[model samples]
Target: MAGTDHSVAPIARGPSIVLVEPQLGENIGMVARAMANFGLADLRLVNPRDGWPSDKARAAASRADHVIDAVRLFDTVEAAVADLTYVLATTARPRDSFKPVRGPDEAGQELRSRIEAGQAGGILFGRERFGLSNEEVGLADEIVTFPVDPAFASLNIAQAVLLMSYEWMKSGRGENSRPRFVAPEVAPASKDDLHRLFHHLEDTLDEVGYFYPPEKREVMVANLRTMLTKAGFAEPEVRTLRGVLKSIDRALGEHRS
Candidate 1:
């Protein structure tokens, strides 16, 4: 085992924390404290209610004043992340939308990898009141979700930010090790990549006349897309699916002969 730093672990490439339309000053200050605790330096505030350079926020920040001082104000979430290549939105409820849902640990790994790969990355934390609008969330490249009791999943904004920061810091230090789980990096397929595969599958289905009754095609295709999307296919797994499609095509050709 390697010796790990028990102190606030700094990520080799830290992610910018963006608070979009946040409501409370105290929460902002606490978020700064949390970010500083885990060595996340960049903070962007979009349309804050209590305004910036707040004394209450500074007081809550305590020794984390550096984070507060480094905070940048933006008019919009898109403006805040205009230069970022990878953007992740933190949310509590899972939606039936088309996007990848990553736990904080996985999100941290992805963030670090992107940063190391010379990509600008950021994560959006929505307003304390309503959370991010579906439109606001649509701007993100991925979604980072925390695992909480299904019965009660509402987490304080600062708490959510802190938890993610903790996981990210731990991930950077290689502390998020589980003995039984498979490492996703070995030919792992990202959710976005997997989405492409699902689309391809549906397209192939159309070509082979799998869908009938033009009126029912939409519903059937949607159901099929959802089924495969939730199965969590990897890169190799998607490749295998393509292989299966190819084999089916060959058999169909032989039968036609």
Candidate 2:
């Protein structure tokens, strides 16, 4: 797990991720990547098939070193979540248990509320093939499910982590909440900063002949800029991006010369 940020204003913590009898090291690694993407750190594994200290998993993490380094191993799901006050068990199939079934959004909000009130909580993900057993689901405070295509409702373990982690990270962004610090080198992106970045990228793309097929240029440019804008790059992020563009442009010019 990544170390907590100890800035003047402490950061809010996301729940521990407990993987029950996960079969693949690659999947576990990708799960770590997803969790890190959404500001989650803690990871507890219950009897991983490949066992711990898996270099394959770490390599798949793609520099999510903190999460890979701090991965916790556990004997069972019951023991894994024993310290959590509220545990949400994830399942694809409906069960006979009458526990509240929450969509990711509601569960995230509730987890935030619980954490704010000093309760520790975590989410449980089951094995890739079978998913959480009935006994495992029974131990949770509630259940979480995705509204997916009924005929093909399967989700990869990493996809599940990304969705749930997104909701968890999204929950703490209310008006009253202090914004989480982005990186030590930069702050949250402003609208104007994003606008400049949009132009910078589009200009570079045009120069590089990326806007091919003259008729498709406008729509293609719009799509490209829109996707980059959604990333919400910070000040340093914008600068670094422009630097990348300059580097690429220079490289291209050298090749032409």
Candidate 3:
């Protein structure tokens, strides 16, 4: 945890951060610094390797006094998250836990959603090198994994904290989303628009004998509708598709004639 004095800007509310068997006081301080960067204040230490109340940690923390001052220690991962309703384990590899897996972004959203619904949540950061043990991961309700290169999946403890904390903050501020390049003022796809597109497509396909044998027609038609309905084409897109279908039909008819 090389000290980054980018200034500490803690938030009012966020999930607890539990460090399980963290190896270094410096890394712990950096994790605290990262947490403070995204407004996360709750810091829980689970059996830190070098013991607690280290002046080295405080020195590394720089300006994250709020996070360091209120650090809580626990002997085990279960005890760390016992008071919380939801717990997420940050792991780079698949673990024994068959719990729901999500990316940092999705995990952040889930955490925020659960918190909003009156559920307490926390994210567990494993040891610096080997990461969370399978038994430790099993305790979490969901697993948050990063999509890093398989050849090198490990990340620093502070780096992991920064990524999740950033996502969590973005979700709360409604900024944790990709940019939408929609055409100006174009309303997104509606159910009715999609239904109309499906109907038109089915009618066109019927004329084209796409359903084949009569016995298989109902099932075939339903399947076709299912495929198109899932697309959820926007109103403009639906109109364009209908036009394309009519053009194709006209071309087929002319060819037949």
Candidate 4:
């Protein structure tokens, strides 16, 4: 296993590769091949155009049958990442949105930290045609934009996956801390824990007037939830955060009075 998930012993923490609204089966297959090449195993599809489990994709995947076979399907991005604690959205072009952006190396370090804190962390890849929507990008805890020549920056889906996967795998093999074969002690956060923390944080944010438009509240909430969950905060850490929020609220109230 390239990445280890202490949550599920003998189970690796190869970040889930989510292809949101992918258009072509061949791309999906190729992405799978890339993942397999880098020791990633989980493949998730959200509203793919060409359809999943397609023989065309399998054929393209070549020796990556394990990735193709384990492909999980979902109708929406939210559903696809419901179980993930930390998520990074990959994009060649910046969205100009006000969210934390990281490169593959920093994102990989963050992912490893989150997993060590015992949370399920993963990355999201958008379609070849449109990349990720602002809405989709917002769902990520951290946005990843690869650095390339200013003239030519676009990367094929498989290339993006390979880059991120490679970084994560490299980080996992800390030379001084643990041997390559020896498993690390970290365990990723569970789906249920992430869901609860997201709700708690959203409620706190709502109370603080962070989300303004009532109409867009749901989407905003969903995006925030996605980002935090993907960061994969540990249960104790989440509890501490909630406490911090409560303290801040109390201080604000006191000042207003």
Query: In terms of lDDT, which candidate is strongest?
Result: 2
The sequence of per-residue lDDT tens digits that candidate 2 reaches over residues 7-106 is: 4332348788999999989999999989877878899999999899898899888777778888999897767876665778999998866677899999
RMSD of each: 9.2, 21.5, 16.4, 7.3
User: Candidates 1 and 3: which is better by lDDT?
Assistant: 3
Clashing pairs in 3: 11-39
Model 2 whole-model lDDT (C-alpha atoms): 0.80
| Distance from true location, Cα of 250 in model 1, Å | 43
TM-score of 4: 0.70
TM-score of each: 0.65, 0.64, 0.64, 0.70
Runs with alpha carbons beyond 4 Å of true place in candidate 4: 1-11, 177-257
Off by over 4 Å in 2: 1-12, 176-257
**Model 3 error, position 129 (Å):** 1.9
lDDT of 1 at 38: 83
lDDT (10s digit) by residue, model 3, range 145-238: 9989999887999999999999998878744454567334444344345455666777788788887887897667555544453343446787
- CA error at residue 192 for candidate 3, angstroms: 48
Off by over 4 Å in 3: 1-9, 175-257
Model 2 TM-score, 2 decimals: 0.64
Report the error of model 2 at residue 247, Å: 77
